[model samples]
Target: MRAIVVTEHGGPEVLHPSEVPAPEPGAGQLAVEVAAAGVNYIDTYHRTGRYPTKPPFTPGVEVAGTVVAVGPGVTGFAAGDLVATADAVGGYAERALVNADRAIAVPAGADLRLAAAALLQGMTAHYLTHSTHPVLPGETVLVHAAAGGMGLLLTQLVKLRGGRVIGTVSTPEKERLAREAGADEVLGYDGFAEAVRDLTGGEGVAAVYDGVGRTTFDGSLAALRRRGVLALYGAASGPVDPVDPMRLAGAGGVYLTRPSLAHYTVTREELAERAGDVLRWVASGELKLHIGRTYPLADARTAHEDLEGRRTTGKLLLIP
Candidate 1:
C-alpha cells in the first residue's frame, strides 16, 4: 500500500507517498478500502507545524469508500457498505481503520468523490449553520472564504434557512461561485469589511462566519450588529493575533466563538446526526458539493500546495 507520510512537519514538500503495509481494523473499527480522501486546511496546519502531530503519521482526516473488513463487536455494518468517515487518522492511503461509530453510510446515489468531499467541511458547515448561532430566517450572514468548499455548502444551507448571505472571496470567479451558491452579495476579500458594511446598508450583519482567520477576524467582528455571532472556524490567511476579550465587546457588543467540528459533534450520536443531515441534503440536491480539485494518492503534496496557496476552490480530495 502507498500512503502519505509526514515524518517531520515543515511544508507541503514534507508530504510524500511511501510504500507501507495495509492496516487492519481494531475492535469497533472498520478497515475501509480507501476510494477517496478529503483534504482540509487542518492538514496544512498539521504539516506546517501550526498544529503539531507526532512523527510518522498519515495526513488525511476523512475517507469515503467500501468497507472491506469489520472489527470485533462492530454492528449494523458489514463488508461492501459504502460509507464516509471523519476524524480518524491514516486515510491518505489505500486503506484506513476507522472507528465504526464515526462512519456514516453514504447515500446510494451520491457520487463517491462528492460524498468524500462532503464529510469534513460539509459537516463543519452543517454545525456552523445549525448549531453555532443557528442562522435564522431574514437574518443577515457574512461568510468568509465563501467560494471555498465549506463556504459554498454553508452559504446554500444558510439560504435554505432563509438567511441572507454575504460572502467574501478573492476574485471575480470566486464571487460568481459564491453568488451561485446563494450568497446574496459577494465581496472581494480585499477591503471586505467596507464591502460588507455597504452591502448591509451600514447596519452590519446578524452573524459573521470567519474562516479566513487573521486577515479578516477584526474586520468580520466590525461588520456585525450588536449581539451578532462571530464564529471563527479556520485561519487560512494566518492565525489570529492574540485578541483581547474586550475586542468582542468593543465591536458591536458581539459574541465570539472558535468552533471546530470535533467539538460540536462530540459523541457518536452527534456525529451521525450531523453527518446524516449533510448526506440527506446532498442526496436531495438541497446542498451541493463544489469539488474543486482532486489529486492521485501520490500527489498529495501538490494538493496541499494548491489548497494552501489559494489555487483552488471548494473541497480538494485525494483519489486513493
Candidate 2:
C-alpha cells in the first residue's frame, strides 16, 4: 500500500510518499479501504514533531471508507459497511485500521469525503459546545480563527444553541466566511479583545472557543467575563507559553481549560452521540461542510503546507 511516512519530523517536506505493507485488522479492529483522509492541524503537528511520535509512522487520524475486513470479536460491522472514524491508527494510506469501538456508521447517502471531513473537527465542536461549557441561550461567546475548518463548525454550532458569536479572523474574506457561518460579529485579530469588549458592552463573553493558541490566548482570556470559560483547544499558530495560575484569577476570575477530543469521548456511547449528531446534521443539511480543497494522497506535504500557511478555508481532504 502507498502511504505518507514520516521517518523524521521537521516540516511538511518531511512527509514522504512510500510503499509500505498494508495494515491488517487486529483484534477488535476493522481494516478499511481508504476512500478519503481528513487533513488537520494535528497532522502538521505530528509532522513537525510538536506532538512527538516514533519514527516511521503515518500521519493521519481521521478517515472515511468502506470496511474490507473485520477482526475477531468485532460486532455490528461487516466487510462492506460504510464507516468513518476520528480515531484511526493511520489514515493517510490506501488502507488503515480502525478500532471498531471508535468507528461510526455513515448514513446511507452521506458523502465519504464529507464524513472524513466532519468527524474529528465536528465531534470536537460537539464536545466544545455541548459538553465543555454548554452554550446557554442568549449568551455570547468568542471564537478565534472563525473561518477555519473547526472555526466554521464552532460558529454554526454556537448559533444552533442560540448563542451569539463574536469571531476573530485575519482578513476580510475570512470575516465574510465567518459571518456566513453565523458569526454575529467578526473582527480582525488586531485589537480583538477590545472589539469583543465593545461588542458586549464591557460585559465580556460567557466563553471563548480558542483554537489559535499563542496568538490568541491572552486576548481570549481578556475577552471572557467573570467566571467565563476559555477553552484552549488547538495550537495552529504555535503552542502557548506556560501561564501562572494568578493570571486566571486576575482576569476577572475566569476559568481556563485545555481540553482534547480524546478526553471528551472516552466511552463508545459518548463517541456515538457526538459523531451521530454531526453526521446527522451533515446528512440532513442542517450543518454545512465547506470543502476547501482536495489533495491526492501522495501530495500530503502540500496539504500540510497549505494548512499551516492558512491559505485554505474549511475542510481539506486527501483522496487515496
Candidate number achieving the greatest TM-score relative to the actual structure: 2
Among these predicted structures, which one has the highest lDDT?
Answer: 2
- CA RMSD, predictions in order: 1.2, 0.9
lDDT of 2 by residue, 1-320 (tens): 99999999888989999999998899999999999999998888878888888888998999999999999999999998999999898899999999999999986766899999999999999999999999999999999889999999999999999999999888888989999999999899999999999999999999999999999899999999999999999999899999999999999899999999999999999999999999889888889999989999999999999999989889999999
The 10 consecutive residues of candidate 1 with the worst lDDT sum are 106-115
Every candidate's lDDT: 0.88, 0.93
Report the error of model 2 at residue 71, Å.
1.4
lDDT (Cα) of model 2: 0.93
Question: Could you give candidate 1's per-residue lDDT for residues 100-171 as a string of tens digits?
Answer: 888888756568898888878888988899999898899999998889998898899899999999888888
- The Cα error of candidate 2 at residue 69, in Å, is 0.8
* lDDT for position 228 in model 1: 88
Q: What clash count does candidate 1 reach?
A: 1
